[model samples]
Each structure stands twice: as structure tokens, then as C-alpha cells.
Target: MNSTLWIVRVVLAVVFLASGTAMLTLSRARMIARLGAWIEAVPIGAVRLLGALEVLAAIGLVVPPLVGIAPMLAAAAASGVFLVMVGAIVLHAREREYLQVVMNLALAAMAVFATWGQLAS
Candidate 1:
């Protein structure tokens, strides 16, 4: 169970980190080309905010627990990831991007399970 949770956390962290970094670094046109119309649906400020949160959450998911201090932060970060994915699902659904919604759902489920397993442990 612990191993499973670690695996999930690492995967989530890697994904979020890459996504957040892209959002932070990419221009609107670049993002639009890569991510489709959903980038235009939200304000640039909101995108930056979400990107910041994701990057922080990614770091939070790994650092505290790995360093053996404030391990509860790992669970908290997992929960944060779940919430972020929930928002992603909402945005993707609103944009009629069903495929993105499904992907978000899977990631959200993994985030939830990771949080649950960590909290239980």
C-alpha cells in the first residue's frame, strides 16, 4: 500500500510539475496550439495562479515526506492535487473536451487514493 502511494505521488508530482512549468513559461499562442481552446476559456491570471499552485503542490507532495518532517503535508498535497484535477475536469468539460475530462478524472482518482493511503498509514 505504501509503495502504491509512493508510486502515485511520484507520478502525480511529475505530471503536475511538467504541466505547471509549461503554463508558467509558455506564451498564450504556444499554449493554445498545444492545449487547444481551453487555454482561451480562462484568464491568463487564473492560469498563472493554477500553475503556481500546481508547482507548489508537486513540491509539497515529495519534499516534506522524503525529508521525514511534516509528513502529513504529503497527504495534504495529494488532496490539493485532487482538487486541482477537479477544477481541470470542470474546465475541460465546459470546453467540451471530453477526452481531457476523462484524463483528469483518472488523475484525480489516483490523487484521492494516494491521499487516502497516506493518511491511513
Candidate 2:
């Protein structure tokens, strides 16, 4: 179980780090513009803030664990991802993007489980 949790943590850390970096840097304005169409009700600044938070969480997921000082930071970061996934599901649902909602929910579940496993251990 420990090994499995470690693997899950590493995979999720890598994925979120890459994704968050992309969100922060890769055509960020364009990506925010795309999201704007679906969530016109939301402020673009808020979305950008969320992107920044994701990047911070991604760093949190890897740094502390790797450094051996505060493994709980990794779990906390996983929790942040879980929260982001919840927001994603809600946004997708509002946009009637049912498939995306499902996918985000699944990812949220995995994050939650991994977070709990890490924290518990």
C-alpha cells in the first residue's frame, strides 16, 4: 500500500506540475480566453489566480516530499488538486460538458484517495 501510494503521489505530482506549468506559461491568455467563453460569469483575474495557486500546489507536491522535511506538504498539495478538480467539475457541469465533468470527478477521487493514504501513513 505504501509503495502504491508513493507511485500514485509521484505520478500525480508530475502530472499536476506539468499541467500547472502549462496553465501558467503556455499561451496563458489564450487558455484563459477559452475558459472565458464557457464561464463568462467568472472573472478572468480569478481564473488566473487559480492558475497561480495550481502552480504553487504543484511545487508543494514535490518539493517537501523530496526534501524529506515535511511529507505532509505533498498531501496538502494533493488536497489542493482535489479542490481544483471539484471546481473543474462544477464549471464543466455548468457548461454542459458532461464528459469533462466526469473525468474531473474521477481525477478528484484519485487525488483524494492518494491524499488520504499519504496523510494516514
Q: Which number leads on lDDT?
A: 1
RMSD of 1: 0.9
The sequence of per-residue lDDT tens digits that candidate 1 reaches over residues 3-121 is 88888889999999988887899998988887678999889999888889989999999898889899999899999999989888998998999999999999999999989987898
**TM-score (C-alpha, index-matched) for candidate 2:** 0.80
lDDT of 1: 0.90
Q: How much is 50 displaced in model 1, in angstroms?
A: 0.6
Sequence-dependent TM-score of model 1: 0.96
Q: Show the colliding residue pairs in model 2.
A: none
Q: For candidate 2, what is the lDDT? A: 0.75
TM-score (all chains, Cα) for each model:
0.96, 0.80
lDDT of each model, Cα atoms only?
0.90, 0.75
Tens digit per residue, CA lDDT, model 2, 20-64:
665566454666454434435556566557768877877776788
